[model samples]
Target: MKMTDLILKYLSIKTEVKIPGFGIFQQKNVPAFYDERLAALLPPAKEFFFTEDFNLKDENFIQFVAKEKNIDINESYAEIAELVNYWKFTLQNKIVLEIPDLGTFYFNDEGNFIFKGKHFSTESPENFGLEELNLSELKNRKSALGKSLENEYKTSRNPFWWLLLIIPVTAIIYLGTQNPELIFGKKSFKNLKKTKTDSVVKSRNLLKDSTKIDSTKSKIPTPKLK
Candidate 1:
């Protein structure tokens, strides 16, 4: 039997058509949008919406469809990937893709690629008796919270930065004190040693002069001996 015939046979409520890894198809009733202005322009939107639950692991089903249609599955997959990538890169670029049995997929003015038959409002809010949502305050609050989180992250990383800075500075100070000539270049160490020797000699001379004054005071005669 043809693939479509097989699919149709298994699509009954009791059979619960399962596309391998994809989820089961279950019928659901969707509510219609009640708008007087839209009702005047077009027929009342359909009350039901048919949506598919995609399966990432449905490669076999995809291959079966490709074989049944006499198409190269790999080439088709690549083409689809390219189309999706292009759409993502050029968000403003609009294109229409029509699958054989499925409906057309086209980008609308709002940059959304909605299914052709989906219900959407084209009229202004006044026509629908609706008011614009006041989301400015909520948006501002979220923005403030984001800023607070950014500041907190900066503060948390501050200590690691201080450690990175201090370690290099400490290492330089240690190396400079240990080998002054390495930093100042040639003869700096010799000059430092000579300065220390001169200071020591000057201190010894001052001590000797104080001792001579004490000896002279001891040598003076008493009054009775004179």
Candidate 2:
């Protein structure tokens, strides 16, 4: 990866990233504020600035690069130094030094430094999904005591939602265990067992009645033959 890309990426999430002999990149957060004319609350935004008054390398920033590239600190230091020298050499030759996502850095004829930054949007898709909050809609809202997140959860979540998940899970478990009758309710299981028991007892009684009839017939037939 190019050094400029690495530096721009580092500046994206960090408050300050300083490279030796290069410069310092800093980020400032502009808080959300109300727009009186629009009657809406503007979202918070980010601002970036560059400074070149210092000549010291930031070890923490170098370490971040080291970790990101999965390299040792020595390699990281060498890479940063090479990039810094390239930027300086480019500027010294009166060539336009452009860093993508940031802006351009160039020296004027009078030995003065100038940084021209591109404007970044603070709107939807890039604004972390924040919307322009309209306060007029809140005029009729009643103030409540609980937290908004808590209230939202209480309203949006169903108290019996767990039952829906639990029922299917329990059925799967019972069926996996080869006991589907347990899933049908204890009363149904008991009735099924009782029906099997009644059928067996009726079969035994019928067998006994047939045996008694057979013995009586045998006793009467022997007398007839005599």
How well does candidate 1 match the true structure, expressed as C-alpha RMSD?
22.8
| Residue 89 error, candidate 2, Å | 0.8
TM-score of 1: 0.24
Question: Against the true structure, candidate 1 has what lDDT?
Answer: 0.51
Per residue, candidate 1 scores C-alpha lDDT tens digits across 23-111 of 33322332334345343233222221223344423454446446656679885455434544553454345656442332345677777
Count steric clashes of candidate 1: 0
RMSD of each: 22.8, 20.3
**lDDT values of the candidates?**
0.51, 0.74
